[model samples]
Target: MVLHAVPPTVPRLLTDRSTSEPDREALVVDGVGALTFGSWQRRATGLAERLRQRRVAPGDRVGLRFGAAEWLDFAVAYVAVQRLGAVAVPVSGDAAPAEVAHALADCAATGLVHGGGAPGWTGGWTHATADGDDDTGDGADLSTSDGLAQILYTSGTTARPKGVAATHANVTYGAGARHRPFRHSRHLLHAFSIGTNAAQVMLMTALLAHPAVVTLPQFTPLRFARAITRWSAGTVFVVPAMAMELLAVADGHDLSSVRLLGSAAAPLPGPVAARLAAAFPNATIVNYYTSTEAAPAQTAMTYDPERPDSVGRPIAGGGLRVTDEDGRPCAPGEIGAVWMRSPAPPRTYVGDTTTSGATFQDGWVRMGDVGYVDDDGFLFLVERDGDLVKTGAHRVSTLQVEAAIHEHPEVADAAVVGLPHEVLGVELAAVIVVSGGAALTPPALRAFLAGRLAPHEIPSLVHVVDKLPRNRGGKVDKRSLRRSLT
Candidate 1:
């Protein structure tokens, strides 16, 4: 089976032609405003032109710090940099000054595009640059498929945030396979924050596809649901937690227009997936699995009740390998580390090629996740290898506890980890979010897990938190949880 390759001029193909058709609705921000295809092209081109005036030449890096909701601005800046053959580096809007400074210096970014009053930057462009002329040339040479397009900083769940360098071709190809088919006139809604590669891909795909995107400043179930209803959007992408929040608010809202719901960033617990399927009976609920470094929708499990745990088969043009510790293939039902190889994989880490080499080997990227393939070829993730907890003589997968706890009807969310212990070496611990008015205690949780898990696997410590600490990407911040415990 041959993997599909993304073309070198994919970006140009998506943006240039769409921009030429002026009156077409190119983008829409829920509470902000809207932009026509012609306006989007001219503005983005002007931004590129302004960057050139600032001496941001080909190969230079431009740091973008803004909320995810600013899709129009991000699209213009991103395409502008790409048009000039420069790299766009997007960091979270809420990143600390030190983190922002590190990314700017690390990527050797020549200019910065941020929201008004963004902290810690001495000088750069803002929306003021949106009106400049297209000085980068109306018809400049097209960028190579392998040319660096952006550097996305990881969430740093275990260590410092690392810059994942993605090429234009890699993103274009990945987007091609993962992009949900929507017409140019289709209205869409998504939370903004292009810091993560998954979100970036969604933004670019929306722009390239010429769909009118409705950006939400932040995710609030009511606001998001209102936007979908207001715009009559046919599609939307969000994490499982966000979906659950929407379901909670869906009580009084009409969501019949939303036909496609894509869930990613974290595992969509089976219960949540089931609830979403029931609520959006006509919509296709897709649970996707991929990392910031690899891009979106690499693998997905559509709302199929028969295979609730499967993350589905690989998307076209992507390949998966379940390998043992030594990097050999594992047979069906045999657990192993999940590795993926794509034609457009990240070439290197922005500041550290050594670490990049360590992550990518012989063209295959290690996901740092442990799971196995069944005889039917579906992938089931057990837990992140980094999150594995060891206790006494046993290696416990935290996901096992998480899954078991999530199975409880009163539980809304759950995260499991290993806490420092004196006698057991390390003991299992859990932080859970329970439904309102539900009573949850350590002893009660222990009893719930009695027969489902081994005595040792039962969480010895349980804490009920209002909400789990999640980074901008929406994954649980286990590192922060551990720090809080200490």
Candidate 2:
């Protein structure tokens, strides 16, 4: 394998890394298996040949579905599809049959490569196992950097999932051929699902970073803590929900080896970030903000006491701007639409041309989020555009209220949303999961929040549940919550 100064496409990323670091451990999926860079390349090459033999061709869509435990196999299948110049469509192994069918039909997938724990739905597409033997050799010409590489579906918390298509250039951008992505650690651990954008980034990291990527088949606070201790992992990543769970169990684990703790996929509440800082002690807590469509462009903020609420500025060459309803850029501190610009070509929704036009323009991708940029250019997310609570004449940020609610001692988890009301356009409502199942009444909770929040910011109605409803992406499912409340 020949190495380029910078791998221009995803296939070259794998082939070059394998030749350069043949003996290095590339991936370690706990409970499944581990693979060296050389072995990974061989398996991927074999799988690509198999896929070609099955008539998988350039630009053809192929679904690669595997369970969390089978991440190694999933990784191989993903690379193989790219090597054959086919578009890889990855869905979680635990996805519903309906979702699998919908994706296959939507892409008119040519084949499905599955492993243990994959859903049974095939939608009449030819299928094969993700298990590839060690056959070492390259196949037909791989896709160019500008060719469509993959189509990732958004986590549909509010509606049906839409396919977001990306080219090889979009996937390989900023990934260097010679330099390691992370310098502080030799191992990076995360529990992001296989079908998520975060997972794709991690996959790229495994290919380019000096660190060996580590993960569990599934995530539990106890399991996560144990992995850190076992591997002496220096870098760790989690979403806000996972961070909260780790905080609850931090007393039971030895997490002193961690140098960096990153939280992504959602905003890291200030209270949670403060607690995490104390819990990790030596680790620097960082929050990452990005969407599937807007990545590999993102904003990263190292935890700062002064700017606890800001999500930092666009990294390096990326750009972030908040715009008003008409797409005019908003002045600093004015909350409005948030757009992130990537140095690489932008990704767009597949098939939905109207939505694609609205979301992606020029090199900027609209983030579908409501936020403001500080005078210093740090971005502060207020709420999802649709989730902002408008009651009477005021606009209330659900995130602000939720952050305050999280400050309460007895609140374990909570979600705030605007419910329909005859008098007001919408009334603020809250559903909370109390810690230790403590009896928390609506009035008592209101009194607790009175000092911390404005009168209108307080929830007009409150309900206690065992756990807040969440989508597969671990985000609060506001649509389902509203339906249940109404």
Candidate 3:
């Protein structure tokens, strides 16, 4: 198999002479405006120069807090910072002030840029100063594949968010490898938040590959459909949740131009994938499983109904291993902890070196996901190891119930766990938190779940908790919840 390698510096690859076309639309923000490659480069270079003038030294961390409208500016600023040998940590606009504060403190950011509202820092950016400077220098001081580029925080399900340190080399290499098969002329649509590694990779890949990118400030079914139609985007990247939302409003939209649909963030439930494949018959639905710690290690399933559950196969320069509790490799079809080893995995967790060293063992990094690889090399994700609910006699995967409950329009947020049961050891339980003004009763929820979940899998007890406890990192804290139940 042939392996593709990317240069250590991503900005250099993106701004190369051949890739920089004066008339090509490099980026488009919904209502704000559009920028051609020539415009984007000039603006990015100017921003880079401004940061340099502000005494932003190489390797300094800069925080970006903006909505989808400023995505183009954010991307350009990100590259600009990299060009100046600085790191850009972009936080989601939807994130709470506390969450924003956590990220800023975690990265020890020297400056912050927000679309609106005052941040907790001295230096920041507003809408007025977005296109102020031209700082493109001939040579950009970047990390040599091993040097740290950005610190992406994980979805803190279990605890406070830990910053995953990604190097310029690792990101560039992963982006290049993933985009190698993609044609450069196609317009790409990404529906994820710019703060996520998935979105970052997509943006970088599109830039490096010279693909036109159409972006939205937030993921809305209507907006997404409209953007697809307006941009004539040939490819799109969506999460399973976004895919479901899009499917709900897909009627009356002309999505004939889309050739490929990349789904990530969570496993595309077999039924959901099937529905998507049916809906977008012309497009190939690629189910990708990746993490902030390890870029995209596997492309388990590829829009084929025949093998719906399979995540596909590992990419080059990466390997997957399924092992039992004893550390021995599990036989085909048997569930085990999913461990992966990537040559260019994240080096460390910023500010938290203790847990960082423990995250990777030998060469394999524990993905914290439980699943098994079949004999044919297909990966099936059962659940996250921490999400496994051990009831009296059965071990259930909370992901199964969460998926089933999410299928209900009223149930916006769902978290499942095992609660202490007097007679049945640990009994299946669920804490359902509804969305919008939707009302959920225990009996109604139980009745709704009856046909969807198995007898053993159904929550024996249901609680209409005000809010399921989420850790600092935004992931459901089952351990903390379990402790409260006990």
Candidate 1: where is the Cα deviation over 4 Å?
Answer: 1-6, 9-11, 123-128, 131-142, 174-180, 183-185
lDDT tens per residue, model 3, 367-442: 8789888888888777887667677677787777776777676764577887877787778778876655778888
**Which tens-of-lDDT digit does each residue in 149-255 have in candidate 1?**
88888888877888888777767663443344565238877774668766776766565564666777677888998888888878788887788677767777777
Q: Pick the candidate with the highest TM-score.
A: 2
**Per-residue lDDT of candidate 2, residues 91-151 (tens digit):** 9888888888888888888868888556455465555554546886657657788899999
Off by over 4 Å in 2: 1-7, 130-132
Give lDDT: candidate 2, residue 425.
Answer: 90
Ranking by TM-score: 2, 1, 3
Clashes of each: 3, 0, 13
Query: Relative to the unseen true structure, what is the C-alpha lDDT of residue 233 in candidate 3, on a scale of 0 to 100?
Result: 76
